[model samples]
Target chain A: MNGSVLSARTLRNLLPALSLLVLLAAIFYLQPRAISYVGFNLMLNLAIPIAFATIAQMCVITVNDLDLSIGTYVGFVACIGATLLSGGIGALPFIKDLQASGALPATLPWIMNTPLAGVLVLLMGIGVYALLGALIHLRNLPSIVVTLGMSFVWLGLSVLVLPVPGGQAPGWIKSLMTLKTPFIPFPIIAAVVIAVAAHILIMKTSYGAVLRGAGGNPKAIERAGWSLLKVKMAMFALAGFFGMLAGLSLVGLTTSGDANIALRYTLLSIAGVILGGGEFVGGRISPIGAVIGAATLTLAGSFLSFMRIPPDWQIGAQGAILIIVLALRTLIDRAEKRR
Target chain B: MNAEPGFIRRLVAKPWLWAYVAAAAVWLVTILFTGGRGGGEVLTAAFTFATFSVIVGIGQLYVVTLGPGNVDLSIPATITLAGAVATKVMDTQDGLILVGLIVALACGVAVGCFNYALIIILRIPPIIATLSSSFLIQSTAIAYGRGIRIKPPAALADFTTAQVLGMPVLALCVIALAAVMEIVLRRTVYGRWVTAIGQNMRAARLAGVNVGRTRFTAYVMSAVFAGLCGYLLSGFSGGSSLSMGEEYLLTSIALVVIGGSSVAGGYSNVPGLWGAALFLFLVVTMLNTYGFGAGLRYLSTGLIIIAVIVAASARKATR
Candidate 1:
């Protein structure tokens, strides 16, 4: 009896992933040439930023809150990073003088030219997002409205920084992202590390338990003398950090900053989180499940592209799939609750 | 003798009065900044904003009042599809305008019914249900139109262009619609039922209200107005495109929220919504005139919404 129950639980958990694998296999069989190793790598590469954004989205949603500014934050970080790298901030003259005086390496002409610069850009993103988070928590505002508003603010800032898309990513950065080392790609490693860290943080820590308890019953949490604001702020900060990571990964992939790169990711990430078995009312999430879900979505896009579907039609198809997934999840949830 | 404060309270609680005051402020600000861009142009823009606001506002108001975490994310898709269908059908014959309107309304009703089936029969949460429906709507629209643009009929165009006492025909229509909606909401059994459901579904059900039916009806009413808005917009603009309805989705929700409606549902202030609509229009116009660009427009609008919601929350916290 115990063995059967364990098997059923395992089957329940594996259902979504199994379906994804089947779909991938069918696609591969139908289009053998298109489903090459290189194509798979490309799919994984493209899915990296989306997966990161989805993880960020998952963090907020785990608290029973939505962060509508995920896309805008990604856009802001990318544009700012690009602009800083390109000397778009009118610091070219200073950098040139410094280069001539041997104060900076002649080989590296980029502004703030180093891997350390990436850290700064990421910090800036966190700072801005944290400020917004503070406002939301301190003012006791709804996360959706506040985040949506911040998205606009971030978009505007991004436009002001880099009105058009054009920037060269550093060679090292590009190579680090694109080149596969031994058994796995760097991005996959990074994703695994981040996912594991996040999973541990949420599942194994006292803070994680508090966050879950608070989300499940806010009044109870408050009665227990916990600061809801602190928990929310931390979640928002973590989300922002992930958003920066996503933006940086996107920069590495595209080698440029396009204002619209992050737009669809916002909604898609939310869908991905839900698909990964993340509860809307806030609870535990399986990071591996989320990564698989992200892969499934990316594969679906590639499959549609392989079928020669029009761009607009592809968008429509994605939207339809999102709806269908939600409907299915809802149905399944209702059934389980009934049982 | 002791009811003086009560009378004062009633007067102060009047939402229409607040809406008018807000509208006046927006108009005053526009006039001061534009520095006389010709009264005709100002009036034209204001009329356009008012008409658009009324339609979108009505759709949002219904959803917000439906309770149970109900929100129509698919409203924009519905609007876009309705506009496309209206324009396509009306182009064959001027008389087909009526047919187009009926068809659009019917489509809206069908979509609403589908949502109801998902939410009630399938027992999906309202948020997920509406969001899914929105996706289906977008997909259907895309498959059917493939980003195609359709031109409006002459009769509909003329109707949109016509003016009454120096005001646009669309503006007059919007006012009439608002008045009718206000009356329906305040003095009808449907309105009472909606309020009850929004407050507490269990309590409403216990009191003998058909909870499912009320919720369904609310969505249908919301969708119908959304369709009407879409049709009017297409006629007024002289054409319909694939993304025509996308912009209104966020705007409608923002306006409804700014109008002081709780996201959780129950109490709704129609006048507050009108006020929010006026404020949004003014902000957009200002951004345009100042050369703030589309990016800035998006940013500022979002920021303002956040600010307003935050302020409201702060007030609640204080209370």
Candidate 2:
């Protein structure tokens, strides 16, 4: 395609994101100076994790499947990451000897002691979530029910891992998310990298085409000699991978892991995905759109908070937005079909 | 002696029999493990769960049978409004109890009507319409009450709490409601129309079922039941608290599912749901007795629902 053709296609794809950006800008303009920066940065930073989760949700919803356990997976990862990075149970039995004289673990390798342990923790988190997805597929369970069950299981695990939600991520991690050397925080950079990678993997690859085809018509794909099971498994694994990244981002921003963090993300992420123009029955998704949707939701939250709406009212607002988005999508789809 | 038993034949023929059996088994296990608590405590808890579950379950059943992807996500909101309205009305005097009930029912009916308008007139999907209505109702209730808890009148409280034959009056109310629903869903022309619509919308419309009116009536009935449940819960709890109806959202769906209603719509079982409600309460009470705590209770319930759905799916696949 020529440059003009590419540009036009890109513009068509970006309509949803652009609309959301306009909304964010409006919100920013309405806010007073003192709190505006706080609101803008807070929303931008918050969007990172939510955007990742929304992308994950979009992938599953694209396949006409719902994973209610994304929130649970996030909680599991956060708790696990916190425990691993914080070290075991205040002081390990062997570490107690070194700590007796107010000394750290001198014999341990630097990699074991540093925040780099987060990589291993992230792997574990992804593994656990993928295993859950596998179980759902193996049992041929409805993704909604299986994930709903997994949420509870993950909650139990979170409680077991971090009973009181006091475990903290390394100081460097928090700084990475909040500190801005120029105009953007490190987490946003990380999100962009992930988003670009995901976009390329989903849009540019044969696997992406096959996945989209499978989503649109799994039976047709199966009859065409494609492995539906493999497609589903891969989709779920991808969702888990994104969920783990979101969890890490959350931990980085919060500086601590709370079991309760996962509770709202499930619904919020679904809302974000839908708002981003990601079709629930599968096919097209833009990472940029997911980010925009997350940004819009975060701005809405900040706006509501600024208006001094009560906590319950915040939930009501989110619910209202979800319904409106769904309604609009249905109407749009009907119109398109009519055309 | 050669003839098969009538009851056995009937039980075998009933589609929901297996659901009832499954629920009964769970209930028995729960009672056994909990060592069959004191009669009064067990009765109160059982009655409370039964009444609450039936009210919510009936609403869900209506939505499930309404077809066109119907499911009332606004049930919790309807219940909340009903509770709030009932409490406010009952605050006047003993003479206003009947008036309170009327007001609660009316509020619920209005919500149902609004839901119908949104879905039918505005052409929104049922799920979307109900969900938005729920949010609107919740926000309105919270803003209006300012999160205040309204105390129920003495007579209303007595109505909820009082027992006949060592059982709470609520249990009898639920049973009566279930019987009425069974007759409404099974014997009436409206019931036949509902089933026909659910089975095939185009065919039903062609056959002169007045599809839109049937759907609207079903939703209205669902909301009224939800309202009644909310009013009873407020009286039972001695007051209406903000977001008190929230817990019923999942529980109602769980009850309907366990009772052999497909979430996709077109089928339901009131008796099965009643049994499931009893089973859920028993399991919850047992879990409490075993000191599993609130977190575990939530986990167990979620897992059970998933397991049931998966099992149902697997069974369907085999068939």
Candidate 3:
């Protein structure tokens, strides 16, 4: 019995990496050209933004709450990163005249283009999410409803900032994201760094244990003299911070912004969390596994494209992948119980 | 004994009262802006559009009433697939209206079963299961219709648009349907089982309630209602498009919440559904009439929803 339990635990931990490796192998087999560094860069660079988004989602899931607005919020941040952070709000209709008439300088280099201004704006966005967490706790409201409502607010803000998706990502962000390393792809290095940092923060700290305890047994945490509300707010703010990272990275890659861009990330991030062995109600999550899961999902898309699947069927294929992975999880869980 | 409050106070204490009051206030504000012009026409339009919201909102309400972490995110996809299949099969033939209706309901049943199977059998969470299933359903819709917009049969379209005494016939029919459902919710054993399971699944099981079956029926019922809405909406709009069901996703959940239904489950406000639906439709119309941009409109909608939820919960807390 002890041996079976140990094996099950090991298998559960290994699934994410194993799935990723198998997928990579399949891709390598399908196209030998994809085995090189350049091909990997082309395939995995987009996974960077997805990995960030999944981490953001895992943060919220850590506190046993979900953020339905994360996708729209990311789009809003991308709008800001492209327009306001880039030193021009030229794309907005009302501000266009101000920019043209020289009333507002063509670029506010010292004031808006600086990294300080961007960081401040992203911090304010995180503050908004923290406030949302406070509201949900104070009123005893459901996170799903509150976040669903907030999605519209973010979507509206995104549109107001960049109405037609024409703003440019700042030069520094683009350069940083595309920075070449010695051997491996930049995205892989970034993913590894993110996963390691998040794992250290969440799985190797005392506060992290308190936060998870707040989700699993709030009464006990309260009895232990910790504030559940504060933990929830911190989780939400952390999620918002990562969401900002995701949006900025996405804009850096695309070099543009749109109100509706990244809207699908809401669902995609949730799938990534589950695919990484996160649970809905237990506050169970793995940061490293989630990043790997996000990369795997992104690679799955490329794999399908390499297989010549039509774009129309790709959505269905994604759905099928989610179902199959979850089905496998169920089988493993049952085996674990039987042991 | 203390004196009982007056009738007005009693009415105000009811949770569903605020939705009706809000609906009336919004309608009045819009009418005042128009200087009373087209007031009847506006009411007619509100009823017609609110009918669709009510149809799907009822289903969503049931699913939500199954407790926290229970929601049908595949509703929009289910509606789309049903509409696509029904229209493509009917092929604009008036005589095959019944056949189309059956086929749409069948699609709903299939989707509901698949969604539940993912949730129960595979042990996936309801939200994720429905969301993933929706992708599959939407892809099937795309493959089947190839983005074709098939017009409804002329007879069916005409019937859907038909009105009597300035009110839509479809609206009246749905009103009756809501009434019947209210009875089922309050008087039937199945309804009580749903309430019990939502309140406490373990306790309900010990009390001999068939928790799984009750939850299953609620989900299936929700999907079936979505199917009906798709069938009717396609006829009303004159065709079925891939994007036709898009708006219903948020609209369904919004209406259910605004209608005074408890998101925590176990409590449902049937009467409030109509009031909330009409209020939502009028809120959009009011914003459009005032010439507000889409950004402002959406912002206000989100703010207003948050305000309503706060007020509702505050009232419950105080009581």
Model 3: how far residue A16 lies from native, Å:
1.9
Question: Candidate 3 on B1-319: residue-level lDDT in tens?
Answer: 2445677677886677788899889989999999999888888999999999899888888888888888998888888888989998889999999999999999989988888888998987799999889888888887777858889988889989999999999999999998988788879998888877778888999999988898898888888888888898899998887877877878888887898988888888677899899998898889888888787777788878888888878978888
Stretches of candidate 2 off by over 4 Å are A1-15, A32-39, A89-141, A162-165, A170-172, A185-195, A282-286, A305-312, A319-339, B2-6, B9-15, B30-40, B67-69, B120-124
User: Can you give the lDDT of residue B35 in candidate 3?
Assistant: 99
| Segments of candidate 1 deviating more than 4 angstroms | A1-9, A85-88, A91-122, A170-172, A183-194, A219-225, A307-311, A323-339, B1-11, B14-20, B34-40, B315-319
How many clashing residue pairs appear in each of the predictions shown? Answer: 3, 1, 0
Candidate 3 or 1, higher TM-score: 3
Colliding pairs, model 3:
none
lDDT per residue (tens digit) for residues A1-339 in model 2: 366555555554665666566555655566665244454565577777888888888778766777777887787777766656655434223344566667864556655456545567667666655665566666766565567567767787676566677577656667766776455545456557766787788777988878878778878888989887777777887888898878877888887887778766886777677667675564656666776677667666666765677655765676566565555555555554454
Q: Which residue pairs in candidate 2 have backbone atoms (N, alpha carbon, C) closer than 3 angstroms, thus clashing?
A: A62-A282
Estimate TM-scores for all models: 0.89, 0.85, 0.95
What does candidate 1's lDDT look like per residue over B1-319, in tens digits? 7799999888775634544565566667666767866545765677676677678788778778877467777788888878888777777478788999998898789888877777776465666666667766876776776655667878888888888777887787777777777777777888888888889889999999998778888888778888887888888887877778877767787777787777667877666766777777777776677777777787778778877787666655675
Ranking by lDDT: 3, 1, 2
Superior candidate under lDDT, 2 versus 3: 3
User: Number of clashing pairs, model 2?
Assistant: 1
Worst 10 residues of 3 chain B by lDDT: B1-10
Deviation of model 2 at A143, angstroms: 3.4
lDDT of 2 by residue, B1-319 (tens): 4355877887775656766676556556666765775635664677676788788898788778766457777788888888887888788377888888998899889989988988875465576567667767887777666756768888888888888777778788788888888788888998888878888889999998899899999888888888888888888888887777876766777777777666556666678777778767866777776778666776687777777777777766786
Lowest summed lDDT over 10 consecutive residues: which window, candidate 1 chain B? B13-22
In candidate 3, what are the lDDT values of residues A1-339, reduced to their tens digit? 899989988988888888889889999889989867888889999898899999999998887888888989999899888877876434444577677887888775454445556557778999999998889877888888888889888888888777788688889999988989889989889999989998998889999888778778888999999988898898888899899999999999999989889988998899888888788877789999999989988888778878887667766877887788788878888999987
